[model samples]
Target: MRELSFHGVTVRFGAGRSALAAVDGVDLTVPAGSVVGLVGESGSGKSTLAKAAVGLVPTTDGEIRLDGAPLRARRDRRRLQMVFQDPYASLDPRMTIGASIAEAVPGRPGRTGRAAEVARLLELVDLDPSRAGSLPSGLSGGQRQRVALARALAAEPDVVLADEITSALDVSVQGSVLNLVRDLRRQLGLTMLFISHNLAVVRYVSDVIAVMYLGRIVEAGPAAEVLTSPRHPYTRTLLDAAPRFGVALDDPVPADSELLDDEPPSPHDPPPGCRFHRRCPIGPLTVPERTVCVEKDPQPAAADRPHRAACHFASDAAPASLEVPAR
Candidate 1:
């Protein structure tokens, strides 16, 4: 298992004043053999970061490292593969599933060897090997996703970047896909960076959770700690917004904990200081001391700390009401 690290990674689109920093100075690490969940709302740059990792998008600055070395060569890039959100769009409609998977297998293995490998991969994803002969159009949405995973694994990559792999599936089938992800991680010791906006889904599959907002990670920690005791106001708001069963309609919302309904600032010209201060429930809008959040940018926690939040008041205790139930 090789580690994937993003050191001050920045991905900008366009040029001059109109440029948009889709992924800005993101410093994150997916530890060897572990799954790190990247969670945030739409337009938070989650997909851009994942795309940059696989060379789909260019980085304006910073470096992406695999196993402690800069990842630049095309050969080295094959070690990292991606499973995108839309199964139908990602797969070739004309190619049989077997042929698609076979195409990813490195080195020109003989026809017999490639066929056997494709069957093995299909079975690994719990798909019938016989279905490999069928085109993607012949499969259901969930089945096509499984085939996509099979193709990524066909490359024998050390790390997989799964970008909202379940969001496009039916809610009923989402659980099965998520379960498959957990099973594959365990069975193959797969290192992954799973991106999603659904906190509940992220909580279910992630060992660690990193919360992104306006192109920067605001909070990250062990899943249990971040979910149960979120430090950033944005993180807390996300948890509160998630659907909770069995809670009475009259259940009191925590004081000063409601997220502002306004849309987030544009990435093309993000606000100075803390980008989230305008929407932060506990920020300058509510707390006087939090004025610093508007005057200065809060840096991430020291590298030695395992659980960190990039906020001046990160040490402040979260409300008990913010705790989410364990899956």
Candidate 2:
């Protein structure tokens, strides 16, 4: 496994003043043989960041490095593979499962060798090797996802970018796919960036967690620490919104609590200073005296810090002052 690092990476669409910053100047690292879960809302740039790493999207500035070396060429990029969310769309309906896996294998392994390799990959993913001849249309949703994972592994990639790989599956199937992810990481020592909107799923498969809001990673740290004691207001809100087993959907929300229902500011013309201030529960919108969040952007914590939050009030008593009502 290889370490993947992004340094001040910025991805912008359009040109000049009309450009939309899908991924702002962000710095993150996926340590070798470890899983770093990237969690956020739908338009928070989690998917965009994954696409940028695999060269599916263009980055305006900064660098992407694998094992500390810059990825400037196409072949170098092949080592960083991605497993997209939709398994049905990712695979070809006409191709057999074995044929799909074989397409990603490097070099000319010849006919017999290729078949053996394909069968091995099928078995690796807990699918019957005999079903290699079956088309994607014949498999279940979870099985197709396993095939997608098998195809990514066929490339022998150093780092895998899994972009919401479980969102489309049924609740029961979601657990199987998630278990496969954990098993793959342990058995293959895979280094991965797992992106998801579900904090519960992320907490299950992640070693570290990074929470993104409107393209910037607002908080990141060890999974246990980030989930149990989140430093950022956005992170706390996400944890609160996550569905608990006993909690009913119709449970009344506190009148004093500010929900995340407010739409985020447009990325095309992001507001000055902290972008989250408009929707921040404890920001200037709630506390009239805290104008700093509206006037100046809060710098992220130093890279060396174990647990970091990009909020000026993270270390202060702000979180204590405005308690988010418990579910």
Candidate 3:
């Protein structure tokens, strides 16, 4: 497994005054042989950061390293492969699953004996090798995603980027796929970056979780610690909005706790100070806190060992229970 590192990574779209920083000066690392989950809402730059790692998108600033070597200069591009969200779009419509998987086997392009390798990959993903001849269109959504994962592994990638690969599948299918990924990581010691908006899914599959807001990471820590006792307010807000395991069904939802109505400020010219200040539920309540929030951007600082948050009022204490009794 290769350690993937992003140092001050920044990706921009368009140019000049209209330029938008899709991924702002972000520093992240996916430790060798561990899965790191990047969780956030849409447009939070999760996908862009993943794409940037494999050189699919250019980084306007910073650098990406694979096991301490520059990602681009490395001769073997197959060491880092991505499994995208859309299985159908990622696969070749006309190609058989076997052929697709075999084609990705590094240094063996169009060579004989690929059938054996293809069958092994199929088994690795828990798919029947007999179905390898089936076209992508003939397979179920879950099966197609497995095929995509198998194809990515055929290259023997040291780091795999699984970007919302199960989002489009049924809940049952999603569980199966996630289980397969978790099992594979344990068995093969595969390093991965798992991106998704579902906090539950992220918690299940990741050892570490990073919460992104706008183009910055607001919180990052051990999956259990961050998910269960989120330090950042944005992390707490997300947990409240999602269907948590401990949240009671009869709990009264706070009327004032809904997300901000306005869309996030444009990344082209992000809001000054805390990018989340406009939507921060706690910031506006106090004068001094509001002043710090509106006047200065909070840098990610250590909250605990291996845990960090970029909030002025971050806490180590577990947040209050979201299960409020109905009035």
Clashing pairs in 1: none
For candidate 1, the TM-score is 0.94
Ordered from best to worst lDDT, the candidate numbers read 1, 2, 3
Prediction-by-prediction clash tally: 0, 0, 0
Candidate 1's error at 35, in angstroms?
0.4
What is the lDDT, from 0 to 100, of the residue 268 in candidate 1? 87
Write one digit per residue (lDDT tens) for candidate 1, span 78-138: 8999999999999999999999999999899999999999999999999999998999999
CA shift of 193, model 2, Å: 0.4
Candidate 2 lDDT over 33-149, as tens digits, reads 999999998899999999999999989998999999999899999999999999999999999989999999989999999999999999999999999999999999999999999
> What TM-score fits each model?
0.94, 0.93, 0.91
Clashes (candidate 3) = 0
Alpha-carbon local distance difference test for all models? 0.87, 0.87, 0.83
The superposed Cα distance between candidate 3 and the true structure at residue 199, in angstroms, equals 0.6
